[model samples]
Target: MEPGAETLYAYANRRRREITEGVNGGSGRIVPVTIAAGTFPFPIDATTRNAIASAATATTLAGGDAYTVPSWLLPTGRFITLDATAIVVVALAISVAFQAVFSAQAAAFAGIADGSVTTHEAVDAILGS
Candidate 1:
């Protein structure tokens, strides 16, 4: 996991570069794909295909808190809250901070706020082969 915001920023930038600007002098090539989802025919465009492929790695980063990013991003301790209602609020804030920071970096890399990389279920749905 990334030890801090700087490392996380670097990793996301690297991932974006690898996908968008590879060795071929900037003119990106389309990968041929055939998708059969069900009785209905599914034809995925290049942007969608790229997003779907990237989602595999992206979702892992998305679930940063569950995957233990809080260890690196936040202070170590059990979250304490006297108010019962505020307990969920406090916990969600800490976890969501870890998630939102990483995901926001991804959005900036892609030049849009369209990352569908939220959970493992999302990746499975988008990238199941």
Candidate 2:
């Protein structure tokens, strides 16, 4: 049989046991999902590159739904009329990474800007060398 592409997932954070007998309102448990294997990285293909180029302009043009760009990236769906791929790629590059925009930081400071890493080699979308 052909496995084709096997996605082996190992979940890191799991609540072994809930809050004991009489706990307060919220203990503040969070579901953390760290990709054990590589997943959707900053797409480097020609198509993705072109999309990002277009979005780069849109980002500035359609600024300040909240004034400042957030640190942890997630598409706001603010630019749905525009190209989705472009917006996502551009956003991932700019706001998702650890360092400033496109700094080639590695070793303790790896991010989407590190061209050396790829989906196959990376454990996470942004990783430290």
Candidate 3:
């Protein structure tokens, strides 16, 4: 039988978790966050996700203006010293990449529900797995 909506949604949730945890199929996606202090390895994990969301919100509220984003923490427990413009650029890119992957997963789930997708391979293709 074809996969049910519950099963497909579960798979999609697992894919999102995998992407956030940066493990299993989601390994090796390191974002090199460069700031005035230096470059740091930003893992695709919960903390980085929160940071991106916060930064994105700040950028939006600032209306694309430049200023100081003070004391942004790095993975190494060190803080980055950078102005708003540079961090906004990095945040925009990171958010876009994540949004694309998640949107693909959502599309896969929707396609499966609508009978447009019938195979595991098709779902994987849409989800980039």
Model 2 lDDT per residue over 46-93, tens place: 333445555655565666231222332222222223233444544455
Leading candidate by TM-score: 3
- Residue pairs in collision within model 2: none
Candidate 1: segments with Cα more than 4 A from true spot: 1-81, 111-129
Off by over 4 Å in 2: 1-39, 66-129
The residue-by-residue lDDT of candidate 3 on 17-122, one tens digit each, is 6765666544424577665566676666656667766776777677766556677666677777656666666676566666777788879888988988777667
Model 1 — TM-score against the truth? 0.24
Q: What would the TM-score be for candidate 3 when compared with the true structure?
A: 0.61
Candidate 3 clashes: the total is 0
- Of 1 and 3, the candidate ahead on lDDT is 3
lDDT per model, in order?
0.33, 0.30, 0.69
Residue pairs with backbone atoms closer than 3 Å in model 3 (clashes): none
Per-residue error (Å), model 2, residue 37? 18
The C-alpha TM-scores of every prediction are: 0.24, 0.23, 0.61
* Number of the top lDDT candidate: 3
